[model samples]
Target: MERSQEYENTAWASPVCDAQEPRLAAAISGRRLPCFGRARPKKIAEGVGSLNVRSMTGRSREVADLMKRRKINILCVQDTRWRGNKAIDNWEMGTSSFFSRANKEGREGVGVVLNAEWKKHMVNVNRCSNRVMSIKLMYGKVTINIISAYAPQVGCSIEEKEDFWEQMDAQITWMGEEERIILGGDLNGHVGRNRNIIERTHGGWGVGERNEESENVVDFAVAFDMAILNTFYKKQENQMWTYCSAGRKSQIDLLMCRRNNLKEIKNFKVINGESVAPQHRLIVIDFEMKEERRGRQQQTSRIKWWMLKDQELKAEFKIKVLDRMVEAEDPDTWWTTSSRHIIEIGEEVCGKTSGKDPSPPRIRNLGVE
Candidate 1:
């Protein structure tokens, strides 16, 4: 189960469905349909993605850009191969907590990157080792613990893998019932397609045969009551495989969440294109949070009175106002109407505000006018 290099086979098979004729026609006519089992719009769904960048030294910014285009809120990074245990900020990419080798060349590093919106909620980061790292973020009323890890390959010693799982178990035990947990990264194991036997964790949509490593992954999930998220949704072969090598493909990199929160997961699939990492495709899952955000306060933009400072623009505004309000009955309504028309003319003559308008300040216990 060691991570393999790039493979040769990149061919994709057509989806098997009743409407294959139209889909095939569309394919032939150079039109592409959305991926199978892709979720439509959801009221509470939030996009989270994971990718093994192999090395995140110079490519972190590119990966962040890809996530932005895909609308990923939080992304788990693995195999960063960075040298330190400090946080790296790429400005546009937001902030990444890199936990890597403290001594020699960094390998098997893990990191977590949050979008600008989520970065403010980040509290503390725990760098357990080069193989494991965790970040805590407060989302409204609930706390979310996101653990990013890179598991040992099958060739590694059993003690190493066991110790890794033990660390993970300890991390999970640290969380309370109210706090949510998401453990994701390159586990380097296949959970297989036998959902009936492993009903507690596997979702029956996994490909390939089960092996000893797969058993290890399954045992870890079963012990912690977590579900392998990628297996829940049906997808094309290309969309299921997270790693490809030598015409061989496998679903090793995965995302797991508490079994109780499994219902919130709307879609999980391997995304194609945006190939920042050639070996691994991004895995994005959409899930709804328990808390809904409050409605935004209503407000109107202020008129651009600065435009009137220019003499030429002031003359233009005067001419437009005169033409629109020369003859008006009802003086009060005419003044109000004329003001709006004059403001429109001023805005057209010059530009409006440059930055985004924030919500108006809330007043505390103030009487209405």
Candidate 2:
């Protein structure tokens, strides 16, 4: 069946409980939470996803299946409600899960799931709190920080909301300027379709109308020089809503990244037809690593200098180069013509090298001799 059709037929189940209110008392009392386990490598994903699973208590298999079917490499999950800080490996499914939750059960929690390919690249996991968690991966020379957050809902107190934003601010500030970040969460706010004062952070393709809570989201983006990636793409009306319940819908789930890295995002939108979470749908963004792309181009453009060792090929290349290097009017023109002809003829005769050296140099030990 079509995904959208399945979505229409699937029954929307009410959440077992409302979103956990920000635990203001603990924050006020200065109580320290246990640090989550740290896991270790880094390869950035082509497709990254975010979903508020509502409660991931018994849905590990289901979540893994969904990720595999959708080809999602990394997933940021909110409201995991999985107590304790540890890593869960589903070897059969080829995915790794890590979570951070409140001491109490059935409350705010967040986690990140990485496919087997990316799992090896995970360098660290920071279970910042029950409401926010992050994982860092090394992708070539770039460090990617993927944060999963669950903010206070509208019913939560102002202080609680403030605390959540403060934690988010601290998390982003702690990251070095050279690092890249992809923050995904059920922030529970409507950024709306208007960019206005927040044009630098908002893409203006959002749904619904702006509210105070969403204003905080926009303000956070602006302050951190991040862009709300979800709002940058135009999608079907149904595909624009991330949260749906009781005949009401809103685009509260969001994915964000640094504004300067916006060009790396190729596509971002809601994924309908999944019933993993009855109330919240999955949203994904497709991005490419700029360094990886450049590396591939550089490798493919390298000349096959090793082939020059062949006497016949070398003679042919020399003749072709001499034919193309006609006398020029000036010294500058002559040098340019000579260099270009040499390179062009060399490539034509010997061809370009593959990504790697076909024959590596051999090492010899002279001590024994």
Candidate 3:
């Protein structure tokens, strides 16, 4: 048994279990494990976090370490600032990274980091543009589509913002109906506190006042039936704000999931102690995923019948069969036991045949079958 350790100054909760101390879902090893910063285990969702890392090239290893310690299985990162699409599988990081970037300039990029276990379940990756990327993961029968997006900033043109939403919607529409969507990144919008209370999708826990971009984001979520996860959970003022500066603090980075999936997601909050991005804090969400059960496989073996054609092989097999037959208690027992003995001796005399049709019918001047 592994000893459990405790950490201070960190809060944890799960909406699904409604427990004071949220429990993490089981790990790949079939063992229940606790998260680093929080103790007390209750059944909670797999950890998925979003961080505006600003740039990921030189800090990939550092970010991976932070995620591993935090027990995050999958992470969506924005503002990568890379210039192309690439997947990083470094041993030191102990995580796999897939990123999509602009073709011209190193701006407005998005990426995803999956732990080693989760990477094996990845079905496919689609890099639509620098601002949009989707990765489909198969957990048994369930196919979950996780999209990482970097929306246009408040200063960007109206045409650019419209284009970004259009592109983002296109990606969502492209997915299959059964596939679950977990979209997260720097949406560059604040849904605010008061209006969120009145909205169906918003849970009234948002920070600050709404801006034009915030209205756009809320409208987009309402149109798509996605629930703003950050607005659903109550947390401290600092924990609600994803972006902070010397004089200004705002809630721009957000995590959005299909409104139907709101129940599966437990806790959503911001971690301010992270050092990856000075302006943006790491936002973490916990949700549960169903794991498939595997059944045991049967064992089998084959005998080489072609070896019987050889006289020497026949003589060896006969001797072994007779020896085994003499040791048997009865005629019926001898018939059952001697057959395997004959094959065992024949294998020593002549090699076993390959599982395939050992001698395929030779086709001369082959034509269409």
- The order by descending TM-score is 2, 3, 1
TM-score for each predicted model, relative to the true structure? 0.65, 0.66, 0.66
Expressed as tens digits, the lDDT of each residue in 1-369 for candidate 3 is 123334323334434454655657654343445335443434423799999998876987778788888888888999888787777765454555554555467887888888788878888999888888889988767778888988898789999999889988899888877678999889888778875244778888887888878877887888888988988998988788888889898999999899877777878978888888888999888988444345554433345555556666677777766666556568788777776776667677766545555454333432322
Per candidate, the number of residue pairs that clash is 1, 5, 4
Q: Cα RMSD (Å) between model 1 and the true structure?
A: 19.7
- Sorting all predicted structures by lDDT, with the top scorer first, yields 2, 3, 1
Angstrom error at residue 148, model 2: 0.2
Best by lDDT: 2
TM-score of 2: 0.66
**Which candidate's TM-score is highest?**
2
Give one digit per residue, the lDDT tens place, for model 2 in 1-369: 699898878756655455544442322222354334422112257699999988877888888888889889899888877667757775444565554555366587888888888887789888778898898998777889999999999999999999899999989989999788999999988989988988878888888898888878988998999999988888877889998899999989999999988988889978888888989999999887655333333334567766777777778888888777688789998998788888888788877756576454533432322
lDDT score, residue 213, model 2?
A: 87
- The whole-model lDDT of each prediction reads 0.76, 0.82, 0.78
Ranked by lDDT, the better of candidates 2 and 3 is 2
Give candidate 1's TM-score.
Answer: 0.65
Q: What is the lDDT of residue 244 in candidate 1?
A: 84
Cα lDDT of candidate 1 equals 0.76
